[model samples]
Target: MDAAVAEAHVAALQGEDAHAAEPFRMSAVKFAMWLFLASEVMFFAGLLGSYLVLRFSHANQFSEEALALNWPLATLNTVVLIGSSLTMALAVSAAQAGQAPRTARFLGFTFVLGVVFLVVKAIEYSTKIHHGIVPSMSLFYASYFTMTGCHALHLIGGLVPVTVVGLRALRGRVDGGKVELVGLYWHFVDLVWIFLFPLLYLI
Candidate 1:
């Protein structure tokens, strides 16, 4: 009888263990992307903080350098980036809806807009360089180039994934989650530009 009671208790414990709930889990890709973006946010925050400090220390120089920037052209680029964000959102929507062709079309639009932004930015840089307004010219110019250059690099990095996913979408081999992940990254890039344009150009 004692042996049988011990065996029954062991069986009950085993059953409880077998029925236990599993630990929570998140998608590895999503978790990684969010972590990456968080680190990027801190990095950009540091850059913007340093820029503000420099701007305050050399107010007059900043104002003088601001004159060299073409706000009108930057405004146009702002519009272009904003348009790209719209297209990216549409691509995500279409992808979620399982509309492969529509997703591809929107993604193509987004890629073109991104290229236009880079081209316009290159033109701006060329104009500045033509006037001998290099980064070594002033603290303001250094800050301007550093911030905008970092931003451009991020945008360029985002474009690669956008191209890959867009091509896959065209082939009907893309998933909504993949497009959504790219959209999150692309939106972050666009948002960084939105902050940068007003700070480095208008203000």
Candidate 2:
């Protein structure tokens, strides 16, 4: 019944039902999500292109002076993120199996992992600020901070929805696909960091 209601709600919003009160579909909500993610991919592509141009332009100047970010800590955070993705997957599986308690358990764990990720990021950003490498300082750090800071802000945005979904799950009110939908976005953010980590810190 919820699926039917979800479909009806989406079709009404998209005016699809007016054309044809037809069979069920992925719904407008899911379609909009795909559109949003596609736009995000393009956005990141532009930022990456800018970063690469700056990197080559400054190779001979400050190449050796990289803040030498805490590689081990970043690597650990990567593991944590990947683990959260797996836990999110498990939440979906438990929901499919009709196990609300287990689903909530996994979802709650993933949310806590997100919080841990933010805390680690705070430490990382604090270190960068401590060394006086503001974005206006140099061309290299300028682009680095701008690109990475934008990514961080998106990550925070992703966390907000995930936190809300987690709270709903705790009360057994959240749908499985809601968890899956938010998880999809959360995982994409993690995947972006997988690329940005090496580009900004290691390379």
Q: Tell me the TM-score of each prediction against the true structure.
A: 0.86, 0.80
Whole-model lDDT per candidate: 0.91, 0.77
Q: Candidate 2: which pairs clash? A: none
Stretches of candidate 2 off by over 4 Å are: 1-25
With candidate 2 superimposed using the best TM-score fit, by how many Å does residue 65's alpha carbon deviate from the native? 3.3
Deviation in Å, model 1, residue 64 alpha carbon? 1.8
Q: Measured by TM-score, how close is model 2 to the native structure? A: 0.80
Residue-by-residue lDDT tens digits, candidate 2, 1-203: 99999998787868956545554466677667878889989999898888788778888654565555577878777888778788878887776676777877887888788778778878887897899867787777787777777777877787787677767767777576677778778777887888888787777
- The residue-by-residue lDDT of candidate 1 on 117-197, one tens digit each, is 999999999998999989998889988899999999999999999999999989987699999999999999988888888
- The candidate that achieves the highest lDDT relative to the unseen native structure: 1
